[model samples]
Target: MLSHLNNFLPRQSSLLMKCNFSKMFCFQCEQTINGKGCTAKGKCGKTAEVSALQDLLIEQLKHLNSVVHHAKENDVKPVTTYSDHFNLEGLFATLTNVNFDEKRFQKYLHKGEKLIETYLKNGGEKLKSVLHENGIQTADFSYSKPLKELIKTGKEFQIDLTEEKRPVTFTKELIMYGLKGGAAYLDHARLLGYEDTSLYHYLSEALQKLSLPVSEFSLESLLEFALQTGNWNLSCMELLNRANTESYGHPEITTVSTTPVDGKCILVSGHDLRDLKLLLEQTDGMGINVYTHGEMLPGNSYPELKKYSHLKGNYGGAWQDQVTEFAKFPGPILMTTNCLVPPPKKYSKRVFTRSSVGYENLKHIEGDDFSELIKVAKKEKGFKNTKKLALKDIIVGFGMNQTLALADLIIDAVKEGAIKHFFLIGGCDGAEKERNYFEKLAEKTPKDTVILTLACGKYRFNKKDLGVIEFKGNKIPRVLDVGQCNDAYSAIQIALALANAFDTDVNSLPLSFAISWFEQKAVSILLTLLHLGIKNIFLGPALPAFIDPSVLDVLVKLFGIRPIGDVDEDLKLMLKN
Candidate 1:
């Protein structure tokens, strides 16, 4: 209904104007369009109204941040209840395909309005006038009216990203996306009971800048904010790394079974370890075997999680393959977080969402109660018979603590030329054919080279038997799996340790990043790399649709960023560098 409604109305038609649909535009993710942006419905299947609502929620967060800052400046301690966490949730909800339900966004908008009202009411006239002068009128906080009123409010905040002078908009979007990614990481850490007041302060400051009127925003300011976003992202990554490690023991290189055992099962998807932990506890001794799916695959590496014998190995390849994979999955599937696609009718009733993940009608776990899911799993026809294994084993774990413990061996391998180079071929995997570039790059990176990968991108070549090499009598796997996407933080740690051991900067190390990006999390990780001054990174399958050529030119000049070319050519180029 969302996509067809937008399609039926022709651009510039009277009906479009009457419904206020002409202001709609979305280029937030890759695969939007080569020329025309996705103005009606996103290629990822989000509707114009959904996109507009996302923008409205972001705008509301900015306003809320502005108020928070104004109250601080006036020495008024604005009462805090949900403002901080809500700011993070609002941005994360906007991430591609994370939350498509309009009702969910409506609740977020209403909550943000209440936070703003609390700030305004407590601050009195002085606070109100301060925000008004900064271009946030009193009526801007009126997001509580109704969904229709909120939908109409989206028009004024529209930035018209399709404008010919796109570099400015592009840069703003890059920073915003990074912020979204940062918020997601923050939320994860916060869930694990980690808190940093200063990080929250910085987040509010960044959002406040984004709340500024379009006329006041400058290319230079946005670019500066983008770099600040990079710094903030680094902190976010550090926080999540700490949270994950403290919650679970530091990961050790552990081999995970790719072959499923015959039993009733629940395929747990997405990136939330806490959700997976709760399900594991609830399903223990209940006869429902649980397997990690997609990003959740890395859960096997954690000692706290792996102790549960039923928390079996990983199932699918990547998030993009879920529609088919979920359908084929015989048992109930629980999406713990994002990176979810709409399931097919055959499996829709059996699929459930928890935490931040939500769909129009998919069942969700409330208060971590997965009893119904366990019941369904017990009743459903699961993997009754084991099939021939396509991928028998996958080497996971290899977090910072684990990888760094082998520093001396790695250093020795480099000195003796047993390890010629290190390639961090990591990031989110997509359905795009060009993603095959990563597979070729990994396959061709000489046997002596150690390939360190994290996130779903590892699926590109993870199943292949890239024979191990012996270093100091150690059989080191050529392809090292470094946990989930958040584990990119661990990869960063390994790079730093390698740099420190060699008495040189990470830039001077024989390391390169050939990253495959699809969503905001990848953007945040890339920014973290830039913040650390690591250069000569190769990025593809097609650069983001939001980046203008001129802006990309700046990235190339400043960071030595290059697009991935022919597989062989890129391989040769990386080696030569």
Candidate 2:
């Protein structure tokens, strides 16, 4: 009788995939090593090959970093140093679901080939020669003797260079993923003509240091990187702010729709503002109406974007609901980033991905090319608008800059007890049922409080019939949609404004943060909040599976980062304590 190999296999394989780079370490992403990595492929379907390629990308980036640092110090000043090289749109492709094209990866592989010439122009030739000789390009990690470990474990607060392969841990990959999102966001802003050379430099340094082997540094040293990331994130947001304002105008306070218009329409989701602008331009007079979906809902608040004649109302609900909404809608959908849950088979062909968003067999729009959207819309016979009851019109454009300008009114509300509390009830939306905790908390909160929100989290209570309260002679409702989760940058601003007005530290203010997170973007925002020394923040519905027990302890101990409990209990806890 043939033996069942399955019986021989470990029911739950835990072995890390052998590193293709130096074979010195095993894959920490743990998704591709002969069923050893997580017992299944990763959520993004990253394989051992992709993991190795990613490491090589990091290795090349570090080589570039060494050159950039050396050249900057010695005044070598190469033409295409790490700053420009690292910011390629390729970084966006590496983010989960950003890109899945094998063809595209090959193109990037070629791009990686050219990167060495650029690095050579800068400062690290010795490293470049070793990189060339090392069979990393053809054979992934044949040199398992030692890995050129970047950010070594236990060294915590240090960035270093080494040829020793440090073991890759799950947390290390998670951190790398966060850095990738930040780097990608920073890159897009640079592409938009908004320049922050310092951020570009820091991003490269950060990316290079992510997995590098290092010696040691204190908590203070680790905080330095986190703060530096914060500083750069500030720079990124500023750059994005400038780019958005210049391209689409500063989002003015305006009401958007949960209801779709009755006629042919298109729903655009994700945060690619440039792609949105391109869509507006293309569909302007084409009889095809455009509607913002998910993060794209804020696009309607930007003045220039709103001016698009064909830009109609929003469609459906949060991204998690898109599988059903997009299926029912008789139109094409354009997704620019994550918040992409796989659409059902029926509506698959009608969707198009721009930038890093990809799904197998779906037509993905690339480059500055948004033409695919127009063609798909034509083929789909335009949208049969599915309209729902209109919710009360609520304002959206309270971005950090704009909200701070309204600090006086907000301050007055708190002083007069017009608003007893400020609840930062926002975060990424997911299909998980546990997310109902957000809405439950919202319902349970006092009527005298204000719901300050951003991102897809607003989908929970944005349509609720909360009566408007007269604060400062202006009748304002409890809820405010402050753009996307990245605009938690705005939430922080509003808090600082209230604190400054009240003359107390931000934590001392009667403000509570209850967030729902499902992805790395949310993870980065949480990290940003922690970096700011904010406390008593409640996260839900579950902490990331990647966070080890030790790391979770540190988070809870240092920041009081509690996971969401029962709504009644959490609300009472927040109110009483």
Candidate 3:
């Protein structure tokens, strides 16, 4: 049965068959151990067993996607809601640091197999014949195999990294990662009642191509598909933007206190605004003060969420700090999405996960009902007294709407040389010491320059008093927080609007990007930049391990993408250009 499965599965194109099997293989993030694949265990604390299970889940999802793709192509009504949402959650679960429970992956595997069965049953004989003719197997596969057997089967599907197959493997991984990011954003939008069937079809088609043999595509074609993933990601991000802004009024420049108030508290982490909104609604007047952590810090800027007086200020810094931060917190923590680190046993009992987030021994919230979470908060002692920090508050909510509202002032400042340059110095933040480069870059920018930031990376220097640039009696913050990583759409809109005001293109403007990426969402945003013909993006602290020399060369030559260097040198170069 294993051999039969291997016959139908996509294989790498390589002449050398020498195999050096490791315990596990994964290199989907910037911090993969030793700048290569993780073998013994994931740096994110994922075990080899969990890694294998995730790989297997992806393989099974590809098979299911093939059925959905062919059904749509053959004019059979595909199960849009089930298949699309399942695909989103399945891929998102495999992203770095999202889900770490082995049992959860097992359940996902079973659910995917059942989804394939449902799609085939709905398509009837005509759909099955169409799929079979296209070399897709419609036969049912058992996910009910024993745990050991399933793990063994999963190990057989580790990514192909042969020297001869690097280019193809790199391009395929790029597309897959972008799709994962897109799926994450789409899922957020879906939760807010925004759905685009075309986006769903595109995802199914892309996954189908990914399941095909390497020989079926050239490097050029795969690269094109990867860029298309970026193009669709732009649409996905726009959809999410609308879903967020429409559901909650557009974010405004608001001051959020970093200090905790005296009351029962719940620290809401991750990037889901909808989750935060729901929690805020449920916890209102319950004496539970909700504090934003990690990417949720931006939630305080939205009008609808801010209306809940109990929605207190932000708590910890970036996601990487959760282990220590979560331990010291006075109450329970709710992890709404990615960037979750495995909690130590000390505080594991106080942590709860929702949606696609999961950990082995921690409690999971099934739906909008955070009753148990609130109950846990009520049992725990909240902050006995308010504590003040050196930085009392930080300003956020410089999204498109807020920024464009000051367009005339910004344009006049630039024209008068009051604001000399614009720097977009933000992306996913990591624990690496080198990531400090972004902080330094932001700090060293000339006082005349404006810095635009998003995602958790802003936490690096968000509290710094960069001072405001005053022009024509108007004060504009030198450091502007443009919301979450998904809010890159707002950053792009700001740039386009500025370009139009200047009567030129974005490239011709005095704007530059120094991106600090650590995950797939950053990859999707990078691809979107490349799709827009943007150039000279400085990416760091390290390049992706999957991008071999050849692929890196293509990116450098085509998009002028460069790796981060000495902070002084990069800053000088950007200012000089």
Against the true structure, whose TM-score is highest? Answer: 3
| Candidate 2 weakest lDDT stretch, 10 residues | 151-160
What is the TM-score of each predicted model, taking all chains together? 0.94, 0.81, 0.95
Local distance difference test, per candidate?
Answer: 0.81, 0.63, 0.88
Query: What is the per-residue lDDT of model 3 for residues 1-577, given as tens digits with 9 covering 90 to 100?
Result: 1222222122212212344545788889988876667788999999999889989988988898888878777777667788789999999999899999988988898888888888888889999889889888877558867777788888889777667787898889899999999999999999999999899889988998899988788889988988889899999999999999999999999999998878899999998999999999898888889999999988999999999999888997999988999999999999999999999999999999988999999899986899999999999999875665444598999999999998999999999999999999999999999999999999999999999999999999998899999888888899999999989999999999999999998888999999999999999999999988898899888777777667776887888888787888888779876
**Candidate 1 vs. true structure, TM-score:** 0.94
- In the range 1-577, model 1's lDDT, one tens digit per residue, is 1221232123212211222346577767766644235667777778777777888888888878888888889876666447889878888888887887878889998888888888878888988888778767776357877887777777566654445445676677788899899999999998899978788888888888766655677776776778878888888889998998899888877788878888899999889898888889988887778999999988998999999999879898898889888888889998877798877678899988876777788887778688888889988888865866556688888888988888888899899988988999999898888888899888888999999999999999999999988977888889888878877888998999899899999888888889988889889888888888888888877667666656666677788877777788778777885
Q: Stretches of candidate 3 above 4 Å error?
A: 1-19, 124-126, 387-390
Q: Is candidate 2 or candidate 3 better by lDDT?
A: 3
Off by over 4 Å in 2: 1-38, 44-85, 121-171, 214-220, 343-345, 384-395
Task: Specify the poorest-scoring 10-residue window by lDDT in model 1.
Answer: 7-16
Candidate 1 residue pairs in backbone clash: none
- Best of the two (2, 3) by TM-score: 3
